[model samples]
Target: MKNKSIFLLVLTLFVIALAACSASGAESSSSESNASESNANSNSNEVIDIVWYPNESGNDMKASRDEIGAIITEVTGKEVEHHLTTDYAIAIETLINNNADLAFMGAVGYVEAKNGNDAIEPVVVPSGASGTLDDAIYHSWLAVDVDKQDDFKVDGEFSLDTLVDKRMSFVSNSSTSGFVVPTSTIIDYFADSSDYGDLTPEDLMEGGSLFSQVLFGNSHQGSAVNLINGNADVAAFCDNCVENYVEAADGEENTVGTVYRVKEGAAEPFNNVIGEEFILISVTPVLNAPIAANLEVLGEEDFKKIQDALASDATANNEEVFVPEDSDASGLFYKTDQERFIPVEDAWFNPIRELSN
Candidate 1:
């Protein structure tokens, strides 16, 4: 009986040791599984960086950008960080430096980026129409307040030549529609004109020599505002901008300015003649602003993913992403007023680059 008790105690000790060994092995396996899962989650949650230049200000701009970022996060399954540049040059530089994976830029900005770094390429363009991206064109206008119509018009006809001794507001010198296009138009106009046929932009813009004074409004909207308030006699502006200003006038009659419309027959700015549109005048050839990606930062697979997200069927129909907060759709970014995004190639903007040069 004594020997039996000793054997039973030995058996119990062995059983406890075996159980402990099994428990430890199971714990080790579980730890490895958890580590593997953590690694995967970390990889999936990588962040994407984006940037844009806000041509306009207000809370609505922030709201729109946030909503777009949310959509991108949902589509790409990655965290998205967005930065708004202080100016057009900064926006271009953001892409050139590869600080931003993607950027929304005007043709002129894109041109600058392309010249600075060939790695930048256009990925998508906003379609103003549901039909095609090619339809997404905007205009540049030369406008004067109603109070100054007599100072510009001769016998009910608007004259571009009258602009020579007036106070003028121009959007940013870097602006495509506001400055580049309008200046190109003006240069072409005088270059081919009978009266000032031999003139050049340098001769025209010599510090109050082009007009009595030249003011930089710094924005399309700001240019329109300056013209409406009588701070300027003629303003280099855009089509959508003037419409928004008129609407903001709140039923005030005659707030509509006399706009210089570009005649279609102009061979170049030289052939361009001014007509009185009473609000918006000549249309600069439409500029299709684009969102581009830096090839060095965004892999081909990831670039395609970003493109798919913006062009996705679901995004096109999302009112929160595309719809304007106000009745003036033209005042909104995307200016398509929520139209779908379409694929675009770099060549599409080459004409703009040539014109800008």
Candidate 2:
């Protein structure tokens, strides 16, 4: 009886040891799997970084950065980061230094990048472009408030002659549509640079030039608001901007209570800048930035993999994409085929440059 009891105790002890060993081994295996999975996830989420120039202030570029980052991350199964450049010129240099994989640029910024960098290329164009050229593809509206003008026609045509000595407002000095492009357009239009054509936003000395005075509204909307509030005789800004004003005017209670229209055919976002049904311009082409991969960092295969990942599903359609309520506001996005970056020299925009501007 004593021997049997001892044997039973020893057997029980052995069984408990075996069970503990098995449990420990299983726990070890689980820990190893978890470590491996964490590593794999980290690698999978690794992605490219890109930046955009703050063309329309830092806001527009910031919106783009958030949107692009989400799109790339979704498409490639990798991560993406879009940052805004504090300085336009430095952003290009960042790309050259290989700190970034892509960048979106405006016309002047693109020109600067193209002139300064050899690796830069035109990766894409806007969808509604009339052609591949650099000008006449987009236009701006030059307007005034309904209360201020009250059906005033400026000689019943789109002529700056009437604006010879009128106080005028521009969106901003850096604005492509607000100042630079339109200034150039107005300059070329009159041919005689003697009056409003010769004036520039830089000459805001208040009664220094043909434009009786000059003011800047800081943003496209601000410029339109200035016009609505009677801040200036004329407001030159993006054509889409005027559309919003028109929409606002149609409101029930919030209506701006205005009925402003452009010089017949030059009405825009609808009739084009010149109020013409289809005015073409070879103006400075609206530029599209490119998402590039550094062969040094990602290698060829991985680079292509990243790009393909982005092209497939990480594009503008992803929910993570940070798009503006009004930007391409109506469900517009760029296609991979159309997204292909073309060389700057290769760009050819559809523009009747002279007739349109």
Candidate 3:
């Protein structure tokens, strides 16, 4: 009878020990799950800093930058710190130094950044139409002042040869549409001698070379203004810039300048033209700038979050941010219209890289 009692006591002890071990395991699992949840919540609330290139400066853009920051915050569920760059070179520098997580850069800036530092990746590009991102190209124009339109005529037809020995203005030496493409076109067109085959980019910029005097107005708007004010006889600028200037004219009788078409053997030449209207002297297919991310600093998961957020319907449907408007509070990009941010790879900008080279 004593042995039977001992067996029962041993069995009771075994059951108690088993229950205790099971409870301990359940408690450990619960604690691990709670810790994971806490960490996730903490990460979701982290703020992300983004740098914006002040391609356009004013009180209007400052307000728009704030609004864009808010949109990125809401869409990505992370805080946003927006840094406005002073110039194009500074914008790329910020990314290279890892001072900023992302930047909105022109095609030339993108190429410069990619070449300078190999730690960047192009995230997205603004879409102008319903097509591939590669087709989202803009045109550049060589504009002449309204008063000097007759000076560029040859037998009453448009002639680029007339631009030789004329004072000219350009947006910037590194500018894609305003300087690079247009300058390359001019160099090729004016390559008459053996030296033309070996002319350097710096040669084109020198006074009394391709032009009598070369002036960089620093910005496209500034270049246009330089032409209007007679600081230059001709200006290298963008196609959209002319439209913006004319729209802001408020129907003034005296117009600003005219964009001319380049005659390079077209059967129907773009004739002598001047005024608010654009006559394409040379049209360059230029891709709109892109927003790139620093891959070394941003993780894959977070990068995916930002990419998804930017391409979301929320951003696309937000008219105030996507569409351009005249008001200061109307947002920064595509304010007059809506643009969808499409995903792009680094290879997408290879064409631009080649062009720059």
For model 3, the stretches where C-alpha displacement exceeds 4 angstroms are 1-47, 192-197, 240-245, 248-280, 324-332, 335-338
Give the deviation of candidate 2 from the true structure as CA RMSD. Answer: 24.5
lDDT of all predictions: 0.58, 0.42, 0.57
Residues 168-255, model 3: lDDT tens digits = 8887776777777677667666566563555556776767666789898766766766776677888877754333234322222222
What TM-score would each prediction reach against the true structure? 0.72, 0.52, 0.72
Candidate 1 segments whose C-alpha is farther than 4 A from its true place: 1-45, 193-206, 240-278, 324-338
lDDT of 1 by residue, 43-97 (tens): 2336566666646332335555666667666656666666654466666776787
In model 1, the worst 10-residue window by lDDT is 21-30
lDDT of 2 by residue, 1-357 (tens): 322213323333332221100000000000111111112222222645555443322332334345545444444555655544444455556555555555554444444454455555433333222222222123455665544443434554334456667777776554556666556555555555554445443554345565677777755556655665566777765643344224423323211222343334322223333321111111222223334433443445545444443433234234323233343432123232322222222222111121112
